[model samples]
Target: MNTQLQVKNNTNELHHILTRLENESTRKEDLIIPARNLMFHEDGFIYDRSSNKIDGYVLNEWATGQFAQKTNIPSKYFRQCPPELKAVNANHWIKELSSDEDWMLRTMRSRDGSPGVVRGIMSDKYVPFDDIEILNILDDVLAKFNKDYEIEMWNRGDTGCHLRVTFPDLTTSVGKLTNGAPDIHRVGFHMMNSEVGKSSIRITPMVYRMICTNGLMGWDTNGDVFQQRHIYLNHDEISNRVTGAIGKALKLGDNMINDLLKAKETEIENPYDVIDQIAKDNKYSQKLTGIIHESFDRERGNTAFHVVQALTLASQTLNADSRTEMERKASQVLNKLVVGL
Candidate 1:
């Protein structure tokens, strides 16, 4: 006999036996229960808890016949009556076999769905500039600043140069200063999450908006736009507008405005710092920052919503390059957050 064929035949035999059990279950009203239970003891059979014909002997027999034909197995094994068949109940066999099969299937499915890397795109648009010109300008800027960086330009798509600068690992100390001002453009370096501790930084879609608006208005800096606005030169007004816009975009509470502002102010150096400070400042009051921190601590995981919110706040506050970096980082983190969940 062919080995493979023999294995196939053995499988068919098991299937046929199961089918016979099903058929026998349908032959007698009282015996239907025991027959159904016997059928459940075999592999590849699911108990239909919703079915009301558990006492239908003829139906059970028909089902068993179908199952035996499908599996290509003989029914004699199932029909055999053991010496202690009445003592060894069918329900006992069913409970054990069904549990094992259920567990095996669950394990197989779980192994198949493990998390993996996620990818996303980050895009930003800026004023039309000659690729060579932007490249030269970027080279000069990096050189003048005594930094190591590279620039690449694309002329056809967004009508602007695409510059990518590689920076050294960013520390909490560096990120702390980022909150105070837009340092990336001048510094040629920015912070991102690292496996060591902090989060990674990458370009985000907000970079496009920032670039388009700035390019349209001919402003070198986002702060320039704020300065040009004909508003009362009061910290409260500026802070409120900045915080409110970001809060709305992020879907955070009004009280979180300060923490968001502070995070933006510090250039998103340390999110934990912002959370800690907000918690301290709002010790006697309601603050979103504290709530978020507590929630994160409780879950021991990050949420896409919070990451997106942070990206929005960063866009509102950071300079073009830094904003782009934050967006990229947020995108990267968002993927992990989604997969982890």
Candidate 2:
């Protein structure tokens, strides 16, 4: 058979099987994650009858916990589900596990939805860039920065990859310093591989603050980040897209540094008053307010620049919903103060 004909046949077959699985009353309890690895059983009821229907089924809590610990899925969803058992309620729990980067889904069924003796397979391995490709990309970009920047690999695991290229001890003076200011800041660009809803790669820009040492992405309102996704595995086209993005990313980094330098020029005579006003205006939590105060003291003084840094630090600690809110609020506050508000 032709490749196209075979592909169409496979699609129709999968749909037919899934329809049966969805309709079968007993299949709900019998359906496992390919192996007996995970089973959805009736809660607190013993399986004493062959024809017993599953009114409601939950994942085996203890078994799922053990599986999570072994597979390391528990930590990945730490913010969403600190307790691994709660992950059962998450959307498509079995599907997510089956589609995990490190594992594949297996099944034992025929094209007509019969209980075949042999098991089949469904694999999910959709990495845009492998280790060799990533290394080559970094090599090309690092040469653009010369030997002035330091390279750090934060993560290069199964899920995603991150690289931070920083220019050490390179900073612009913020505000007029009469008593000799400190040079403790550095500027950098963060390159990462992130997928939006497991769909496509979304290109983004990050700003690194020395005080908190947080590399926050999508904080700037410059619209410098470009979002792109590869529809096909065409190496040349993919490389070209990334190469073009690299040039734009460097320009965006420069623009971000320039903006920070401009903010530094607008000095605040009473730093405490401005900080207090920001806290009250934004209704910052008590914990966040305390952290901001600690950051102010740790940085050893206050300027418009320090205020930006402190708030950015606070945003890092916030929950996802609040973090986005804080990023917006910080921008508004900084814009007002930058023009001597």
Candidate 3:
């Protein structure tokens, strides 16, 4: 079966996948600094040294929130403070309250409105298990997946990434295609990671629609195929864990197929209601909620499968992290209706 490239994320189109990842790896600079050495400046965080100060380390949204939490202050209140007040609050807390242990500040060169952005602040023990390194480990597990599997979809951004690869031999038929052919859904994996402390490295099952290039990633009641936080894990241990996880994912293909088949048969009396509720319950932004409605209208299918497909289709244009979240939510919608699959 030919793998369909969804949206603009084809691996070949990206010049070279590993090269792109290597570029990301190069842009990062991780520093381990004592909490007491930290201070906040106007619109940035500072490394306060009397003789030689490093002040360009601006806190990105995530890092700012983290810093606020660390200082025992609410992020909203912290951001609203005057520049001098912010510094005072930050310095006072860092000096008086913080422990002596070193903290890791994950930073990137200033870009996209963030100047020398500290994307994450974590304990010094936080392992730097980023995407490039993890994929290298997978190379050993799946023979680099060069001969059999293909990287059909890719989403990359400063926040995180989701890589979707297709498994040709593990497809199952579901629904009907636009060309009067059986709709084929293939089993695959959605490898997700966050270098900026957004999420743990995770592998979830993927359901890809060959007909319309729609794909949804999800966790069943069983959860991810693999999930490991970037903490206290040595290289050898993570490698062993990844090898076992991928092996298990390949063998466990039937659940996703069964779910899609059931979704195809299950009709929703009111998709909009369900969609609206799910989006609201999940605290989806107004923009994302609108996308789902538009996708549903365009697809014009009444079955639960169609609703899920609409969500996945809508997700195609989102940023990597948002797309992953949207697809995960779509899968939950399908799962809620026909669970055992």
Q: Residue 302, candidate 3: how far off, in angstroms?
A: 2.3
Give TM-scores for every candidate, taking all chains together and pairing residue i with residue i.
Answer: 0.21, 0.50, 0.82
lDDT at 152, model 3: 67
Once superposed on the true structure, which residue ranges of model 3 sit more than 4 Å away at CA?
1-15, 23-27, 41-45, 50-56, 80-85, 109-116, 144-147, 285-287
TM-score of 2: 0.50
Query: If ranked by TM-score, best first, what sequence of candidates would result?
Result: 3, 2, 1
Score residue 179 of candidate 2 by CA lDDT: 50
Q: Tens digits of per-residue lDDT for model 3 on 56-88?
A: 677767787888987788899988888788888
Q: Give the per-residue Cα lDDT of candidate 3 at 57.
A: 71
Q: Evaluated with lDDT, which candidate comes out highest?
A: 3
Per-residue lDDT of 273 in model 2: 75
Superior candidate under TM-score, 2 versus 3: 3
In terms of TM-score, the best-performing candidate is 3
lDDT of each: 0.28, 0.46, 0.75
Q: Which ten contiguous residues of candidate 3 have the minimum total lDDT?
A: 1-10
Q: Write the per-residue lDDT of candidate 2 for residues 43-113, one digit (tens) a residue.
A: 32112122332222322333334344434556345234533344443323444454333322221233464
lDDT of 1 by residue, 1-341 (tens): 00111111222343343354344333212112222233332332233343543211111232333333323334454335342441233334444433322210000011233321111101111111122322233333434445333221111111111222222321012122213642221111111111111122111111111111111111121211111122133444534443333223222222222232333333334556644554465341344444445544532223343433444343434444444443444433433333321
Error of 2 at 303 (Å): 3.3
